[model samples]
Target: MLTEINFDGIVGPSHNYAGLSVGNLASTRNFGRTSRPRDAALQGLAKMRLCLDLGLAQGWFMPQDRPNQAWLGRMGTDMSLATAELRYAAMSASSMWAANAATVSPGADTADGLCHLTPANLVTMPHRSHEWTGTLAQLRLAFANSASFAVHEPVPAPFGDEGAANHMRLCSAHGQPGLEVFVYGLQGGSFPARQHRQASAAVARLHRLPAERTILTQQSEEAIAAGAFHNDVVAVANENVLFTHEQAFADREGLYAELREKLPQVVILEVPTSAVSLADAIASYLFNAQLVTRPGGGMALILPGEAKATPSVWNWLQTLLSGNGPIRELHVADLRESMANGGGPACLRLRVVADPATVDPRFLASADRITRVEEVVRKHWPEEIAPDDLARPGLWNAVASARMRLLDALGLAEL
Candidate 1:
């Protein structure tokens, strides 16, 4: 059975590298002139590398558009040249730049995939320029499972807005005979348009199939701007429809209560308050309420700020993967001045696939046990070089580069 899921791991400098920044760069809205360019480049490289690594480590294949690009040479063993090119094109287009340009494409392999496109609609127009590249990539990775794949089109306009899309709130799926949910933002003009009614209608229609349901929330006025409100929240899995009523922008406990009432059999946990941020909230909503499977075969309640607030989130994730289960997590960091402008971790990637058997649970387990990344190198790579060599940024890069060579020696392909 398929048992692993790919997720967007943390994006930031390599703790040892001083020049990398993770996430969307175009949406910072307040980037200064003095931002580090090298760091930005490194960050971008890291993000790209992560995609390639995930594909390799998990045996998952990425769809691409450009096979000639040297970056993808290492991936040839698994990914077809045609698929790689397609993915690259799609990712480049879904980047922050295209989101703002309001340009549309069918999405290429590497140069023109969902990473570069936005749903055509009103609610998403204002934030159209805001890119959620990273989040999309994560969603693609999650959906890359080797079971069933389906794309939900004409996603709700309101929910398709920049913020929601960045959080993967619109189109997301996982597992075989996959579960795909497409969100439509309420449209029809007038600030904070009453699109929920229309959105609800669309959702009902989307879930009309034999094994489908909808999820809705009553969000606060402030949160509503973020499109966090809905009337009835439903999730369909294993031919079961789970429903719940949520108060958007509610406190952690309030959110938990709603989830408990809707899916009482599942265990719910409130994310720590310290991790609360707009990005964290959106991710929590999507993962906890929408996608994650609870301890008891029901939806899990993940309060908005819990994942960021506590390291326990990682610990819990580790526990789940230890047994070959599918799970995903998102973490946000502040990157005000990096290449591409500025944004959180969710805005720099695009989706390409969501297959579980393709993923290796060991990677997730490694991520969970890793308290200090340096330890990863120590435990995984002890002979190539001494740990002190990685202390310097330039030296660290050299070490990283050399480590890549070691990976190649061990049959690890470069991307």
Candidate 2:
């Protein structure tokens, strides 16, 4: 049966707070602090469990080979000789945000009747630019069922694409053909726009989505300036319900009109600035929550724990739940490590509509699988990584081997 599978990137052993992202408010705010990789990975695992308990299928991608030695070789220097900036970039665990791993167009929405996936060419950030190649490898391996899936290489760089983070689909159900929205940015003044309009348009072409069902919209510069680096930071859609902030798009009313024209059933739950300011929403990652359909009925908002702490955001959410809206449930996930680096519940997974059987079994999530992965994590992941520790060769070796051990445990040693 066709269903939605959320592929989460297992937090890597190299996970640290180097704060390499420029426009990410949390990344900069928590810069130069210590990071707990083991705890982070465990926290991610717990979040995945929450997903499973909610009757959603879950899958995972192993961490990329960090202190990306091969990348450094191309840069004409090994880890020992590279500059501090280069070293930090090479070892970054930013790939843990699998939402940027790729943009997936389900077979239901594609022209060829095969799910199409395009890994994002994250060229805008040094820590993330090198991620596409690694992410591509994982995507290919997981979706190797050629008859049912087509995984495309990222849009060639110079036109930056940040994958599913800037994409959303609205339909009556997961198996139905849907209206796909590609949100991009033209300018953000001081903060550079990461998702280029051309890149998003290119992805639509690559996926072969129908022109009538696709809406390429521009993100509001004001939202980007307020630290909404990716569209998912301000909005998320599951089926027909679009839970978003008021100032999320450049032409909010126009975009809504287009959406209604394309998919009249689209329920846009827009939170007003009066109730929750952009600052509060960005800080708590309110819209970064996964707006997923629950098993019994209705929908649930899986928000970060920080959202509950932000009074304005929490109050608004409470009011939302109290109303007769389609969103009737709420689940708070503790993701302090990820939140500190500016990723929330939505940032950690790539939503793909497909049968669980099509995915590589080793990557599928279950209670038993989580246990096995947890053992490897407990045994190998670093207890903590100080910013200065990233410069040490010992840390590099540990990070590399830890990932390999995870691969071995999962019978994916070839990766």
Candidate 3:
């Protein structure tokens, strides 16, 4: 049967606070702090376990080979002779945020009746620009069955694309045809707009989505200034329910009109600034929560622990729970390690609508598979990573070996 599957990226062994992200406030604020790689991976594993416990289908992506000597070689340097900036970029574990991995169109919504995926170029950030190649490789391997899935190359550069982080879909159910929404940003902001309008349009065209069912809206500069770097940082959607901050879109009312007209069952639960300011929302990553449909019937918000502690956010959440809203349950995760680097529950996974049996079994998550991955992490992932550690060859070797061991364990040694 067709269903929603969440493929979370296992936190990498080199996860550290080198402050490579330009507009990410948390990364900047936590710059130079020590990071616990083992704990971070285990925390992600626990979150995956939570999804499994909730009777959701789970899958995973292994960390990419790090101290990416290949990317550095193209830049005319290797790890040994690279500058601090280059080294930091090469060793970054930002891939742990799989939300940027790809934009997906389910078989139900695509013109060809096959699921389609396009990896994001992520050209806006130096640290993330090199991720598409690695991401595409894994995507092709996991969804290799030609009759079931079609994975496409990224939209060419000069037009930035941040993938599924800036995309959303609304439908009566996971298996049905849906209204796809593409959120883009314009120039002239304190922060660079990562998702270009042209890029969003290109992906829609590439996926062959019907024009009438697609909505392309601009993300508000107001939200960007407040550190809402990705649309998912301010808004998230599951089936027909949109859980968002009021200031998330430049023309939220117009967007909602189109959404409602196309799918009238749509329920937009917008939080107002009076109750929770954009600053509070972004700082707490309240909207970054995964608003997912529970296995039986209701909807649940998988939020970071930071949201539960923030007074304003928590207050509004209580109000939401007490009301007759679509979101019926609240689940909080201790993602301190990821939160420090500016990723919440939503950032760690890429969601796809498909038959679980159609996907490669090796990529699917089970308790036994998770236990094996966790064992490898415990054995090899570093205990702590200081900012200065990114420059050390010893750390690079460990990071590379840990990923190789994971790939071997999963029988994906070719990757």
Candidate 4:
């Protein structure tokens, strides 16, 4: 049987406010503000623990070292040429959102009968563009069984790939073959369109997914302009249910018609424009939610704390919960640290479908591992980080030391 594993990235000590993502409203609004790395890490850990309590399979990815010297060398930039954005990009801890780590195809969906992973080439933003290499290395290390797993190089660039953030899968159960939906942005509008159609098609082909089981669609330009930087920002799916805003896609009606015709059992839980405007959805991150099958025999919605604060969102959620639908529970995870930077509960993890015993044991989480990770965050992580802190003479060393200490504690020092 296939189990859905959530591999969340540990927030690093180098976490700071850079406002690096263009279409992300929170990132822009919180730019240059003081950030509490310790608090951020703790918040993420708390969310993971909540998932554990819910009986969800959980794992973790280590943070990448900041002020990556090798990446700096690749850019050939010295201190003189380092602008604030450039410096922030070099030291960005955005890798903590592992949703952009890679596009995963479960063993059931691939032709080779092995799970496949393709690290995303996040070429849209300079800060994220440097993450693919390190992300790929970590992925390979965490999923090391060559006979059961195939971790591929990123699709060649010029075709920006944002990984699973723009992808969704729908199936009757974890072990069954599913319909893979690839969402791409045709226009950047005010921000860059990170995933290209060509890149999405390439990844689908690489997995050798049957054409009859795949769907490619364009994201709405209005959504991008309103800060829906990734498709997950406006849509989410679990099993046969797709929770999305009315304006999430360029051709919403047509897409729904096709989805219904193809999947037959597909349930499109679309939020009408009048009830919750597209702008309101983006502001509340209503679509950036984790839709999961509960152990109690029904579905649940895992939303960030911000959703509770938004009146429309909260009301709509209540309505959904009161109805005779698949979603029977509403969970609120306090992910303010991640939310302030344009991410939510769903952004913190990459979903992998496989047996826990089949994956690399080092990446799996247990009570002991969670306690150790909490200890590391509480003891070594910084209380606060400012925008200018990236330029401090010993900042790099400090961040690296913290990360190394955590890796050692987690027995993942090789990464």
Candidate closest to the true structure, highest lDDT? 2
> Mind sharing the TM-score for model 2?
0.99
Candidates in order have lDDT scores of 0.30, 0.94, 0.93, 0.88
Per-residue lDDT of candidate 3, residues 97-117 (tens digit): 999999999999999999999
In candidate 4, what are the lDDT values of residues 1-415, reduced to their tens digit?
5789989989989998999988889999999899999999999988888888889999988899787777877778843467766788888999999999999989898888899899999998889999998999988988888877889999998999999999999888877888899999977576778899999999999988889889999999988988899999999998889999988999988888888887899899999888888888887888888888877678888889888899988999899888998889988988888898999988999999988887888889887788898998898898898877888857778888999999999788887
User: Can you write out model 1's per-residue Cα lDDT over 1-415, one digit (the tens) per residue?
Assistant: 3232323322222221111121221322322223332344234334434433344222211111111123334445322333522222222212322111111111211121222222223233322222232334433343344234322333344443332321122112222222222333332123242334354344334324222322333334434444332211111111123222122333435544554554444333323334343343433332323233432343232222333444544454445445433333332332323222333232332222333343433223232233233333343322321223323345334434533543343232322
Instruction: Tell me the spans in candidate 2 whose CA falls farther than 4 Å from its real position.
Output: none
Candidate 3 vs. true structure, TM-score: 0.99
Question: What is the TM-score ranking, best to worst?
Answer: 2, 3, 4, 1
Per-residue lDDT, model 3, residue 192, is 87
Residue 349 displacement (Å), model 3: 0.6
Q: What is the lDDT of residue 300 in candidate 1?
A: 30
What are the models' TM-scores? Answer: 0.38, 0.99, 0.99, 0.98
Question: What are the RMSDs of all candidates, in order?
Answer: 13.4, 0.7, 0.8, 1.2
Q: Which of the two candidates, 1 or 4, achieves a greater TM-score against the reference? A: 4
lDDT of 3: 0.93
lDDT of 2 by residue, 137-228 (tens): 98889999998899999999799999999999999999999999999997776999999999999999999999999999999999999999
As for lDDT, the candidate ahead, 1 or 3, is: 3
Pick out the ten consecutive residues of candidate 3 with the lowest summed lDDT.
Answer: 185-194
